[model samples]
Target: MSDKAKLVLGDKTVELPVFTGSEGEKAIDITKLRAETGFVTLDSGYMNTGACTSAVTFLDGELGILKYRGHSIEELAEKSSFLETSYLVFYGKLPTASELKVFEEKIASYNDVPEGIKTMIKAFPKDAHPMAVLSSNMVSLSAYYHDLCAQDLTPAQKDEVIVQLMGQLKVVAAYAYRHSQGLEFIKSDGSLDYCSDFIYMMTGNKNVSKEVAKALDVLLILHVDHEQNCSTSSVRMVGSSKANIFATISAGVDALWGPLHGGANQAVLEMLEEIKNSGKDYKTFLAEVKDKNSSSRLMGFGHRVYKNFDPRAKIIKVACDSVLKTLGVKDPLLDIAKGLEEVALRDEYFVSRKLYPNVDFYSGIIYRALGIPTNMFTVMFAMGRLPGWLAQWKEMVEQSGFKICRPRQIFTGDTKNTYIEIKSRS
Candidate 1:
């Protein structure tokens, strides 16, 4: 509404320029706040802060809008494959027919991971968490491709690294899944496309149905990119120091491994199990969630970013029904999930609070139908989020005004303290 926002102090005034994005999202430029007025804004968790302006994805949480490079998510999910969407996220444009053919062929050519990496993966315990294994191998990739991540690298060299990582990470995830199950690792099939190959490797089912492959492709597309999520920010923070992609992505994997970040789907399943085991009806459990008297809480029903419905949830809900019906899955847990969602939508308490089912709500249920274990939930999330992290990191490297992400903090501890010898203190 205004070109600049004015803040008044006792005797001085500060004017910060108000910047609006292409989607009409506004953020005040606070870069000069500390310098001009010796005051820095304190925004814990950066909920209201604009850390950086990104051109990769646009999200309006209140309106439930999410778009990647100007394409509506629904369009991509219905029409494009994961590889095509990933290329769009990475390069900020959809690949042309010829470009798509070349990119897919190149990815196929670099499918298998290094043998040494596989040997190392085998050494981990069979019960080892897949995310840990995935991160370890991703970091180890730096050693195998040192030249690509070396200093003074060219744009073409970095692109090679990106391509290699994108293709091989699928292999790495498949290996991690097989490793966790103590199953022999399977090589990627050159005949399969990206999502199909991943499904094949994970399940060792040569004839994965067309429905399953399309389901996974849409899932990946829905999660292709979100604007500056925690793991993506973690990636940009580490990459700001000019870290190698492997190391930076490893940081992201660790961040996503946290329960609060990428484990919501697992938490959702655990919550469902808790409710089912408690012998309480869905309505009773939901009442406890609203009452707060019981220690019960609803997981995956709401998101921190979105105050309205999660746009992805709308699409995924339809896909969830289709996948289950097509596969003839009849899990009682899914029935419970559906029951919970139905009750939440009809109840006034949930509707007033905007606590509708988020994307993780349905994604978890579908993954269960697809036979993905609770432990591998976050690993699957990492696979979907890979392109977003890479796109953010690459933008930081090529764009201007990005530096090592060091935040200013208010000093609340003792300003000065004398070092006391142990005897003297006693």
Candidate 2:
């Protein structure tokens, strides 16, 4: 095989170098294509583009494989805590006992968010979206803590930023929810673990069940990193401009609030609620979903990337069950969600297309069981995704050759035409 891919357009031939990743993933490096040939490839939705090469998370959608630092999701979810997985994702290695201790201590040290941040969350209306409040408070951190944002951060300074976000993001998430509920803010418990502490802060109770903490820890580990998804890309894109850490994350929080990204779980819950209120059985609704003429569709049945199954879904599905059993909570929406999963898995229409239950399918159910309201689901996702965003931003900043991400587009409109004056236009 040649070292370059030759693209012959008419009589002009272009040579684009090929690059291979550690896992044999191949891409034709087109960094110089437009510069040399005065032409650029068009990839709509970036469906066929590789924005950046990353070592943080590896995802194989076809095979339903997800790994972090070369460890399988199953292994990490079962054996590692969220903080441990976070350390691995950022530093490229699991932490030693002493390292883990120091990391935990660092988190504990920075756990308390500023009074102004608490005040900011309270300022939002009671019915305001938690994501909106969360993003506002997140960006405010940059203004409150200017020392953490350096145009060129040293390794220690970068780590400090990462640790600070890891420490405070959960508090912000929980506080935002409380403010939405018109409840008072709760501080973190020094004795609780990371996930447990967040749960305590959200509910204002340090006494938490063991099973609940385990379930949350596993979910966080599963969400630690995904290869350049929407929010991660948002972080990298905004950070390319040398924005502060909080500002970049604020951008990500907004991106994740979109209905297509981190809002899937919220949609799932809403769909379940809609189905429950429809006065029809799930089987009847499932038929409507299968009918092409009908407008009904399943919310969490399939994924955009995973044609087979979502690896995270397979892991978190069990946690969902465990959480339901542990809390002994009951809801009609959960029953509908469970029934939909069972019937869809067996139905030919679903099985043929591989539209199995995805990660978000049961996540909202689990969140509901834990007493977390539907509106707060995406904020929880932002909390879990914090570490991944930090790692990706840190990697992009540390790369010496990285350029600002400026994607090109083909112009389809008329050019070289004089603009008509507003008064003369018919």
Candidate 3:
């Protein structure tokens, strides 16, 4: 195999070194392309770009494989708790029993937020989107924990912040849900496990079913990390500027608020609701999705990275069914979701295109079964994704020869326009 790729610009030729990842993925290093050739590659949306090399998560979209710290996501989801998975994603190894206990204790210790954060949550209008409340409160944590925002943090200080964020984000997510519903906030006493405690706080139900908590834990494990996604990229971009961890995570939260990212699950729920309310069967709606002229889309039916199938979706789908059965919640939207998935799986139009159900499809169903409102869906995503964002930030700052993210742009607009006075302008 060639160690370098040859590029020809007019009569000049240059060799760019080739880099290969552990998973056999290859990229031609273009670090010096613009400097040597006075040109840059144009990759809109960064679809083919490798922003940074990472060891936190490995995603083989073509094969529908996802792993954290070299451990398969399936194993983690089945055998490990969310907290355990979080430790693996952040620390790059599965924790021993004693190490896990210490990690859990540290997370539980920081579960409660300061009173000012509660006040901040109350100040938002009841109708404000939970993502807005989440992002705002996430950034405000820096004001409460000065060490988290310090420009120069010791390794111990950084570790503490990681633990603090893993714990507090769950509390904030529950608070955002309660605030949106005009309910009183429930404080975590740290008696239950991470997912159980979150369920207790969100619903004020001390004895949430173990199955429900475990299902939520699985969902969180599934979402812990995905290569360089939009939100993770946002975290890296902000962290590259030497921004505080709180602010960097806040940027990620804001990015996840977009419908194209973390809000995907919420959109899936809305699509199900629309089908139910319209009195249309899943087949009828899917027909519209097949029509090129119709604007209707089969939300959660496909993924950007996983063209074959979403590995997380396979796990979450089972959890979704189990939760529905355990809760005995007769939700019509869930029925509609199930119907859509059943038909889409065998439908040639969908099969040929590989438009299988992704993680977002059934996650909303599980959340709904757990009594989580639609608006709070993204908040749950932010909570699950907290560890991933922190891990990405930590990796960026700790990397050797770290450079701030500054992408080059090809300007197409007029560059030499003469300035015109306001009165003379047409």
Candidate 4:
């Protein structure tokens, strides 16, 4: 096999070195391609680009595989808590018993945000989106910890910021949810585990059931990381400019706010609601989804990355069922969702296209069963995804020979045009 790829130009030939990942994924090293050949590859939507190498998470979409720090998602979801999974994702190893205790304590200690931040949350309109409020509060953390946000930091300071962000983000999310309901903020309770504490704060329930909390923990673990996703990429891109961690993560929150990303779960719930309220049966509604000319669309039946079934979806489906049963909450939307899922799974139109159920499919069902409003779903996603964003940002900054992320583009517009004076325009 050749060690390099030969690229031929009009009268020039260049040999680009080939690099392979540990998993045998191969890429042509293009670092010197433009320098040598004066030509650049155009990958729209970055569909074929590998921006940077990472060890945080490995995903094989075709194989339906996802792992963090080399631990399978199935194993982690079954045996690990959200905080432990977070430690593994951020620090690249499962903490020792004592190390885990210290990590949890540090995060619990940083859970409380400044009182002024609560005041800020209260000032947003009652109908304001929680994501907007959450992002605002995240960036504002820089105001409280200026030293930690500096470009150069001691190793201890970096560790503190990581723990601090992980702890405070849930509080901010809870406060944002409370503010949306025009309710008073609930202070964090260090006595409870991370997911239980978050549920308590969000719902003002001190005695949250163990089953519910564990379900939430599994969901968070599933979302902790995926390889170079939109929001994770946003974090790395913003952090590359030497921006503070708070601002960089805020960029991720904003990116995740899009309907096509973290908001997909919320959209899934909304689609179910629409179907239920339309008085149409699941089979009838799905017919519209299959129609090429119909405006109706399926929100969570497929994924962009996973050519096979989504591994997270399988785990969360069980959790979703368990939580709904544990709470004894009967939501009509769940019936509709199940009906759609059953048809989509066996229907030739869907099966042939591999449009299977994804993580977003059942997550909103679980969130709704827990009494979380639809608007708050993405905020929950952001909370779950924070560790991944932090790890990516931390990895990018600490890497040797790191460069600012500046993507090249092929412009498609008028090359040169004279500006017309407004008064003289005919």
lDDT of 4 by residue, 1-426 (tens): 687999889888899999898788888999998898889999998887999999899898889999999999999999998889999988899999999999999999987899888889999999999999999999998988889888977778889988999899989999898888878888899999998899889999989888888888888899999889899999999999999889999999999998778988999999998988888887888899899999666888777778789999999888887888889988888888888899788888888888888888999999887778899999999989999998888888889989999999998999999999999999
Candidate 3 C-alpha lDDT tens digits along 1-426: 898999999999999999999888899999999999999999999989999999899898889999999999999998999888888888898899999999999999987789999999999999999899989998999898876687757889888999998888888888888888899998896889998898888888889888888888899899999879999999999989888988999999999988778898899999888888888877888899899999767888877788888999999988877888888877777778888889888888899887888888989989988888899888888888989998888888888989999999999998798989999999
Q: Over 4 Å off in model 3, which ranges? A: 290-296, 345-353
All-Cα superposition RMSD per candidate: 1.9, 1.9, 1.6, 1.6
Per candidate, the number of residue pairs that clash is: 0, 0, 0, 0
Which model is ahead, 1 or 3, in terms of lDDT?
Answer: 3
**Pairs clashing in candidate 4?**
none
Off-target runs (Cα >4 Å) in candidate 1 are 287-296, 346-349, 424-426
Number of the candidate with higher lDDT, 1 or 2: 2
- Model 4 alpha-carbon drift over 4 Å, by segment: 290-296, 347-349
lDDT of 1 by residue, 142-174 (tens): 888878676545888867777787888888888
lDDT of 2: 0.86
lDDT of 2 by residue, 365-406 (tens): 888888788998888888889989999998998888978888
Candidate 4 displacement at residue 11 in angstroms: 4.4
RMSD of 1: 1.9
